[model samples]
Target: MKRILSAALTLPLLAAVGACGAYGSSAQPSGPQPRAAAATASAGALPTAPGSVTIGSADFPESELLAHLYADAMKARGVRTEIHADIGERAVSMAALKEGSIGAIPEYTGDLLAYLSSASTARTPQDIYARLRQAAGAQGLTVTAYAPAQDADTVTVTRATADTYHLSSIGDLKTVAHRLAFGAPAPTRTLPYGLPGLKSAYGVTFRQFVPLAPTGTITQNALRNNTVDAADIFSTDPFIPRYKLVSLKDPKHIFAAQNIVPLFRRDVLTQPMADACDAVSAKLTTTALAELDSQVANGASPDAVATTWLTATGLAH
Candidate 1:
């Protein structure tokens, strides 16, 4: 989705997303700790076993769906595969990639960039991916070219909550954020574009921070059921429109461009396998991804969704 931030956003806050700590109330809480920090002992020190072909995913529907697509495409090319679904967020996912627990996983370019360096100023998709590629290369990871499909993070609210707070943009939450409870995946609370970004960029802090699961269903249910007054949701999530939730504008580009991509361990990525993944990346557009995600969210198995899309695109038969 193309975001057009309204004129209401203050000009000075434009720089808040990049280098903060100077802009806000300084109430940034230490968010959820990543689960992978414990396993870094073997990271980069040992090579993944040569005979294995495993794909992993973050603990969310889209990530799992993408994993299924990649595995199926590789399988069609005579490479057998196994999937490790719901493997937590970037921290855990990255650890899996580093230690060879997983040969590959689905990832977003900008988010991966931010994880490497939260202060990075890469904005456009090309710049972000280039920076991400360089950073990832240094760590023995390979980043494939990104897809047209993007799902930038958004600070969303129910229509009722939006109306109550007159919330139209991220900046609009500045005044009443303290009274609201914010919900999102554990990693988001600490990500620069998540709670910290909100606090620095908009001087927004909530009454409480609820570290919920990364799954869209669980996150959306919390919002719809009033478990939390606000949430950080992905832009392409089907529930954004289906549930009539309002995704607030981000004029500062805090969340940045998040095109879909595959992250592979350098040792595990072969020419044929990389090409198989790239074929899917080239064919998977935002609209196509949304449909696939919707099917999975509504009870269709990710294997089934992957089969249909791969068959239609001629990536698998």
Candidate 2:
């Protein structure tokens, strides 16, 4: 559910890749780094010092909810924790982590991988997590176990549109695509899994391309009003069900796996701290995430939603 800001959209993918690579190469000033030294501690091991940690989240509600889940669970295990939500996007949040402003943040595996290494070829959850761990390590970060829940980029259309066009999958759009308009964030037009990949992978080409905001508002309105026949929506967006939209299946795996995971400053993670976060991942499921998103979309507080889920799952008493 991360949105690439319009300013970033101006850069070509290759240029952005180079910029990310350069940022990764810059050395961080030595100070009190996260406790990555305790990484060898076995899963479920207690942290040497349980009472000192800060949890960070991105600008979105789901990320905030995830942050709460981690923070609450760690607190349950006697880890001193603080939540810093709405801390901006990955770049800003990651900077905060490295500078010791935050100990950990909720992250999506595929996106993290792409940010760390744009040339990454990892696609499935396991492969993406493996590459993400290695890449994060190089940048002085530690990645915890990934949850089954994912919020991936999806090509979706109104149920009416799907029925009319007999579109059940991305491949089915090949024949009717030329007659339809497509909508998504501006950068999606060039991202490897966006417009270019759609045509190359499925031989589907739209009559027109519309650039819309990633908030789901613009794209949803465009699709609902018939201004655009289809749009790129997040897989976990509650509006999809509210509007009865059909998310076309991507048998060709056009988008990379984006399982939710914890990315933290290596120096801050202790064996017990890692285990506490991993326990959350072990119980989190796609259905649960969708329901939580729906509740938040319906006006529930992110912290409330997260707490309810954690309690229900026995992660919090």
| Model 1, CA-based lDDT | 0.68
lDDT tens digits, residue span 1-317, model 1: 11111111121111001111111211111222111111122244333232347999776566778999988997887676899987776778788888888999988777688787678898666677767777877788777667777666667789999899898777898999889999876766687767887789888989999987555667778999999988766666666657777777666667677777888887776555666777887777655775676777677888899999999889998
Model 2: colliding residue pairs: 34-267, 34-268, 35-267, 35-268, 36-266, 36-267, 47-272, 51-80
Against the reference, the lDDT scores of all candidates come to 0.68, 0.72
Residue 57 of model 1, lDDT score: 76
> Roughly what TM-score does model 2 have, to 2 decimal places?
0.82
Best model per TM-score: 2
| Candidate 1 backbone collisions, by pair | none
Which 10 successive residues of model 2 have the least lDDT summed?
14-23
